[model samples]
Target: MNSESSAQIDVTKPHPARRYDYWLGGSVNYEADRASADAVAEAFPTIHLAALENRSFLRRVVTYLAAEAGISQFLDIGAGLPTAGNVHEIAQDITPAARIVYVDNDPIVLAHARTLLDSSAQGATAYLDADVRDPERILTHPNLLATLDLSKPVALMLVAIVHFLTDDDHPHDLVRRLCDALPPGSYLVMSHGTDDYLDIEDRAETSAANQRSGVPFQLRSTAEFSRFFTGFDLVAPGITSVTTWRPEGWRPHPRKEAVSMLGGVGRIGTRAVG
Candidate 1:
């Protein structure tokens, strides 16, 4: 990136994506992000495990999308700093013809997304610098258009990103707008953090810390989070914690509920399109 663009980044403040990278043991974060992430870990010692389980959920969902659902294209919005088992990796690993379009607005994330652009000989990859609040922009972006065919089913991946948006952001509408543009057979694969499982005080403290960090975090209830799939058909083991979402015998963390994030994969209703 040019110096002018780089100057816009304040390394002194933590970014949600970078902080997540820190928790996932990625080397792309700065001191500010690490410090904030450490504080979150101290307050909720299971956060790192939550991050791991969240990524694991992404892997399992992507595999199902590619191998079972026969989805060959993915629109992974708010794709944080790349790590192992990324959407494209898991998708293309199953169907080498899979194509992926990753969207994010973080400078560091944009810089690192180049790695996400690498794909198998039979597939393709693309990156777009866009924000989650404006799903229209992503849906219309030239890169996304070039990489994915909206006329066909796409696995829209929103893993662990919606929590960053507050109620005022109308995240539900934003998500709906994105899904509305997809064909009827498309799927929505998402996970969101919640305060439902935490003590009131613990939830308050975590919310306060995140607020002070200049990053908004909203922990919703399971019912509220499930609203994201209102018009779709949920996969089996629907709307459960990421740890228990089709466990597939992969339990990488203890006290799974401490992760406190719910995930589900929902296929857009094919009957609705006619």
Candidate 2:
């Protein structure tokens, strides 16, 4: 756990993080990742739109958190392979001293995290080879300790990650534990997949296809996803489609239900859990 050699990359088995990188058009993916993604696309044709929309929402949320909400620190759990407009870039672009820590368990992502460490002189950046399931490990990691101030308001970003936590994992409790560590006035910028738009038949096919590929994914309902924000208050455009959340004039692209997801930025209260 202390060394990079601890977590070895398995090129033969596809990882969700790598598959996501592939969807975002980053070259840091393998044939297994591409094949896994292609299978998902075959089940859900407009999967590309989902990837783009999630990234777009991340842009708006980060901008709002740094520029408007005045959050100076960000803890992005399940941080996938870095691409355009990463959390540190967006936050530091607005406030040069903003600090960011990227948490991920993917060996490929952990290996490539050096690219994510190029921070502005005024800001700080670090990466942790930690799993989201182990909230305490991530919260107390030396990298996080060096990069972030836990007493200050920090944005806990779980964008496009919870769906990978199967029902048996108690992902909502996992979310609560992560959020509980942040101070008051902090925010949870979260997004999740749901079968809200997909028909029951398509949903079944999607789940079956991913199971065949050994992907641990579970699609929840809007109410189920909303429970992750139990102790907080949602920003305007509460829990709507990714493109519909406080959308800029350019959002809600022609792809309608293809990018279907419920996303929001919720402000935490004084207590740990509400």
Candidate 3:
């Protein structure tokens, strides 16, 4: 869609994209988003930490993909509002010609695409109003394929978004279908929410609150998160806390909260699933 058309996107419902933007301290969120986020936050106090760790994971994994894995094209599925150090920015910094396609069903994301998420002239960026479950639509979307070459190795990032898919959404099968379409040497980067560290009552309360918001939030176990990366070679460190995966030198702040999120990056190859 053109810039003018994209501006007509809905601003009413509490979109997950905008709620996430608010969590990241961005200004693109609406009141409804703030309300929804406030409710979720009140129930799950660690959400803020999860958001930070999740974003950090995105940055670290993208850097690894571009610098070490030598990938130039990125397909960021369910990509929320473009924030600091987005996929293209990180990748293009390492390889100037890196191409990226940011996919989301939220219209608000598209409205801000050309401005908030501009790409370097040497590289390319595009947005699509597509759902995560619709792999074929996303893969075949003209705008997506225009910027990304499916034939070549690409990093398919689904960080912090799969949990938005409830059981009926069949998130596991959806991920597998998307991976099956990619060529060997491609990669899948995922970070999912979990309740492993929470008490039973807290977990139940948090789950119920998320359900009330019209968006079903599914928190999986470490093993469950790993299942999404099946049929691929897990990168060094495998699935672990975001801080533990390729941790930088700076010591992390003392934990005021507990962490229940699990994340990791995996590589695809011609051999059997890793």
lDDT of 1 by residue, 1-274 (tens): 1111222667898898999998898898999898888777766888988998898888888888888889999999989888887887888888898999988888888777667887888999988888899887888888888889899999899999999999999999888888888998899999999888888889878877666666778889999998899878999999888878777764454554589898999999864321
TM-score-superior candidate, 2 or 3: 2
Report the error of model 2 at residue 110, Å: 1.4
Residues 134-224, candidate 3: write the lDDT tens digits. 8998888888767778889888899889988988899888998888888899998988888777788998888888976655689888888
Per-residue C-alpha lDDT of model 2 across residues 1-274, encoded as one tens digit per residue: 1224446679998998999999998899998889889988888888888998899899999999888999999999988998989998999999999999998888888888877898899999988888899998998889899889999899999999989999888898888888888889999998888888888899888888888766788877899988888868889978888878777885336444687677878999998554
Against the true structure, whose lDDT is highest? 2
Consecutive 10-residue window with the lowest summed lDDT within model 2:
1-10
Ranking by TM-score: 2, 1, 3
Give the Cα lDDT of each candidate.
Answer: 0.84, 0.86, 0.82
lDDT of 1: 0.84
- Model 3 alpha-carbon miss at residue 169, Å: 1.0
Scored against the true structure, residue 108 in model 2 reaches a CA lDDT of: 88
Best by TM-score: 2
